[model samples]
Target: MLNRIETYYDAVPRSSARAEEFGPLTLFVQEGQGWPYYARPALGHEGDVPVAAVEKVRARQRELGVPEAFEWVAETTPGLRAAVEATGLTVHEHPLMVLEGEPLPVPEPEGFTVRLVGADDAALDTAVAAPFAAFDAPVAPGTSARVADRITAGLTRLAAALDATGSAHAAGQHQPVGTVTEVVGVGTVPAARRQGLGLAVTAALVADARAHGTELVFLTASDADVARLYGRLGFRTIATALIAEA
Candidate 1:
């Protein structure tokens, strides 16, 4: 699974329109959107990173007009975190998790119904707002349109939990969560917490992924408590991730 995750990480940059190769490292520049989309170092294989690799990465980020950030999976390339930190970049750690199991039923809590949503403007708005509200971050301009494009491209599957009045209460998505299907963006409104809406939306997407022939699923937990919540659905930590930024 670790090997597969490494391969997935390597392929992400290649999927972008603006990807440049630097030996084992790939730089993904998504017009300065942010981490994951911004300029970052992702290893294609385990090997000694050239002493000048860090300089080259920063140079490319400059050329692309994005901040120099390196998201490295330590399990994929041992010692990579230390190498990145040596370049004076701050590093943050996160749990890398994966799920593999037969489909498990997720009972929808009363007053909520989970279903797949299309790329319509209203649906997209609700889906995008859920995450922003949950994270306490202001919604960036053009986020909805960008996500709508991805959805139109058939690269994303969104699921939402609606109440009796058909109002969105919780939402999530399953897009190629990295080479493997992953449940991401699971969020519930403050008024909807402790009602199993998160589980409902997540399980709905998991079932959708399975129906589409995806076997292995993966996701990253924001913290240990969130990891424990996902554990209830059979996800387990398979590795750790390091996000280094200048």
Candidate 2:
């Protein structure tokens, strides 16, 4: 399962980013409209990685004006954490979770409807802005070329909880590659949180993935508490997901 998950990790970014090799690391660089990417242990690589190699990847990220970030599974790349820490970066640990069986049924909480967000939906921009608001990111910029285009093409799937006004209160997405899909960016706006909106949106994504033949679904939670929330949706922690950012 871990190998399959790792392979999916290596495959998803390749569809939308350029992979730059740095010894044992592969930095995924996205030059266009997609979200920023990061470095990870080169696919199939094993054993210790020299600190100097990590330094070079960081230097290249700096040169490209991208985030100096690296992500990997702790059990698969045990030596990377120490090298990342040696560079004075902050490393965070997240629970690497996988769906064990059918997800627990999550009925739409009162006052919100959860469904897949269509590319040309009238409230598309509002849907895009929802997660940004939930994460307290800068006000979401105007939507021009949206990830929803990819959703429409079947490359990705976005689910959101919308109020009566058709504006999103919570949103999340999953990207399917073959039989695997990774659930990411699940969040609910502060004012709308604690209403079960996050779980509803996530459940929508999971159901959609399963209905479409996606065989593996997984995510990395922000913390133990967040992991427990996902557990309610039937996800189980399988490993530690690590991220180091400068």
Candidate 3:
């Protein structure tokens, strides 16, 4: 399962980025304007990674003007967290979850509809930008416009929970590699929390993945508490996902 997850990780960035090797680390460089991909332990490379190797990867990331970020499965690369932290980077741990049971039914908020967002959808901007705001990232100018291109290319699929006024209050996306898909960036606006808008968006993405022939779905929750929320959708923690940023 770890190998399969690593393959999915390696493939998700290929549609928009190219991989560069730095020892056991692979830096995924964005080929055009879009969110920058981060560095990760190369597929199949496991065990203790040296701090020097991590330092080299960060140096290259700085040179390329990309985020000095790293993500890896804790069990797959147990020593990577220490090596990354030795470089003065801060690391965060998340629940690495996979869908192992049926998605429990979740109801949408009142007057809200959840569905996939199309390339030409007029609500694309709001849908795409919702996650950024939900995650507390400043919605910089034109930061999410490439979502349209991504949708058109079938590289990703976005789903949103929209109000009767036709505005998105929650959004998420699933990037697929064959029958396996990874759900990412699913969130609801601060004003919409506790109303099940975020849960509805996630359920929609999970359903869409199955409709498109996806056989596996997984994601990393921000924390243990949040993992319990995703548990409502039948996702269970299988490992700890470690992320480091300099």
Question: RMSD to the native, candidate 2?
Answer: 1.3
Per model, how many backbone clashes are there? 0, 0, 0
Q: Write the per-residue lDDT of candidate 2 for residues 117-138, one digit (tens) a residue.
A: 8888876777677888888886
lDDT of 1 at 37: 58
* Per-prediction TM-score to the true structure, in the order listed: 0.86, 0.96, 0.96
What are the runs in model 3 whose C-alpha is more than 4 Å off? none
Error of 1 at 147 (Å): 2.0
Q: Sort by TM-score, best first: what order?
A: 2, 3, 1
Q: Scored by Cα lDDT, where does model 2 land?
A: 0.89
- Choose 1 or 2, whichever is better by TM-score: 2
Give, for candidate 2, the lowest lDDT window spanning 10 residues: 139-148
lDDT scores of the candidates, listed in order? 0.73, 0.89, 0.88
- Cα lDDT of candidate 3 equals 0.88
- Give the runs in model 2 whose Cα sits over 4 Å from its true position: 139-144
For model 1, the superposed segments whose C-alpha errors exceed 4 Å read 13-16, 31-36, 39-43, 177-179
